[model samples]
Target: MWKGLIKTNRQKEFFKKAERIAEEACKHLTKTDREASFSYETLKVIKDVKYPSMSLAKSEGGEGLSLYELLLMQEKIAEGDGAAALSIGWHMGIMMELSQEQLWDKAAYDRLVKQVVTDQKVVNRAATEPATGSPTRGGVPETKAVKQGDQYRLNGRKSFTSMAEHLDFYIVSAYVEDKDTVGWFLIDRHQAGLSIDKTWDTLGMRGTASDDLVMNDVKVNEGDLVELKSEGKPNAKGWLLHIPACYLGIAVAARNDAIAFAKDFQPNSLNTPIAEVAHIQDKIGEMEWKLMQAHSFLYSTAKKWDEEPEQRGLMGSELAAVKLAVTNTANEVVDLAMRIAGGRGLSKKYPFEKYYRDVRAGLHNPPMDDAVIAMLAKQAISKD
Candidate 1:
């Protein structure tokens, strides 16, 4: 097993469980990748193991695993299947954020936290829109909600709704015309006029089923409208570290696979395995260096967010830096691993090709590269 930085016995136990899940999930990775299919069976396996509740607050009958621990588990799971990790990471991260921030109404949070613990119900925010792009970009949502006699009617479409097929609850963001602000509504899957558009076809992370969520005049109770709008940028969200952790997992998987192949494959021209070849050894060494750099940046940032509550709000720059550095480094690590794997790396018979594609998708995830760089530059100039 690769070296890990698990902090507690509870975390260690959960990490072992994640390892087992990853091992089993790997059995279907090739087939699922080939078909570009979503796997409810894989999700069921995760739910059956009660992995989603690991991040729920202990006060709510959960393990309340720390952000660091959660990221560790996310990375391990992604090693087996990137889409599975990315799919469920949203639920895990959202649950952790809600627990730590207490940003939701008591009744609403209590209602959902119970179901999460008792039923393994999953939830994700439907904030991205076809017209507005990422909500983080500060685009007011085109989805609008109108108050109607203690109920609110919502209408608009959401894009990149990952795990759309299985989410039990969707915390949708929409504009409230009367309030002149954005509001979040917790809508159930069975709500009328709410449907999945099956539009998530992509070159990578295809199994995420990140389809479009269609809401045509869907209505919800007043109590369901949980949070109101905030101006300027939102607060730092440490839970988003899961994004970098996940891609790093994919990179690590590629590195391990390359090493295994190099150690086993003895070319006709070589007296020994290619693992002894200087060029291959150089690539392996470089992969190790990059992995170590990314692991340090990601885990240290996560550890700080967990251990220092006072510093949490001030970690916006650090969070973005971790995501940018780890994701780009992960891409590098995977590329080097593919080099070690040679021509066979691109074959359908090998996993490196899939790793190459999936790791690149990390570049497109939230706290995007350009945004991160611009934020960093602004911060630097302000300091000067």
Candidate 2:
């Protein structure tokens, strides 16, 4: 879709450097104590660098990193602040998927990637409805798109539209009944009939402003439809490697905080640091071990997807497993971080409470944990 990407050794090194910069910039999100209260200025810094375009490849104005390198960047960014990382992670996934579907063009992608590198202008998929849950492909949409001459009219409201107010565009999924099938449309915030119901004051990911998108009769060109046949594809990969990668990073961020906190933490009334205590040490050890496992699994999964980047039937089951595992793992890690921080952790003095809230959303996020497990069970039985 775009050209002149970094496929050389220098470019790969640049990607690593960009990730390090993001890590250094975002490191305080976990330690903020009251992470939800964080302002948008922090996210602005990461966006300015267009670090989200890590998947663009040097040819398309990005580093063209393999899945392993991509995961490395995600882990580093999430370690900074899970919510911020999570907000950005969905965009990373979106851009990659758009490119894979041959929807991204040099004009929009180039300009957008440049601004994305450094701005708070988020790009995300707005498919979840207050009632529809995961908005999985083939899952009937509460929102409908009606064809009106050359343009389409979108009318509906979406919940958990992450980064709503600050985003540049929303790649929305709605049912286009004229086709007797569902379809996706890219709606720009600047369009008429589109408004943000600025009610996003999330307990966690507060900085993300995961607000609501209300469309009365937003008109957009049919050309804005990024993927014509993407919705009901055999596998419906809406929640695949992308979203999980973000939460996966956020989960790791929790682990990173726990490790750092324990290393220097002094137990109340005890003469030794918490790291010296057998029990605390044990918990920290578990956090570390678990984090390693997540890293291995997520990295392996991304690599496999990239290896066969075009094998797009549907990996709903696999994506669900990743989301469930990482979300659970992230929740545990943040919980443990809270425990390690003690009551002070819950206090607005550190990020534990906010992380707790943010991590909890993963449980409710589409590809719900229950759904994934059930699917996995079915897959197992079918194989048997």
By lDDT, who's the top model here?
A: 1
The C-alpha lDDT values of all candidates are: 0.89, 0.66
Q: Write the per-residue lDDT of candidate 1 for residues 191-261, one digit (tens) a residue.
A: 99999988877889987888889999898999998999866667899999999989999999999999999
Question: Taking the tens digit of each residue's C-alpha lDDT, what string does model 2 give over 1-384?
Answer: 001233457545645654664565465554432333333565556555656665665666655556555555555555566566666667776666555555555555555566544443568888888777766534577888898998888899887777777678888888897887767787778999989886665566665667789999889886776554443335545325545555666666566666677787775788977777888777777777776666566666665676775653555566567778877787787777777778878765665676677678767666776777888999999999
The per-residue C-alpha lDDT of model 2 at residue 167 equals 78
Model 2 residue runs over 4 Å out of place are 1-40, 103-122, 137-139, 229-233, 236-239, 308-316
lDDT agreement of model 2 with the native: 0.66
Which candidate achieves the best TM-score against the true structure? 1
Report how far residue 120 has shifted in candidate 1, in Å.
Answer: 0.6
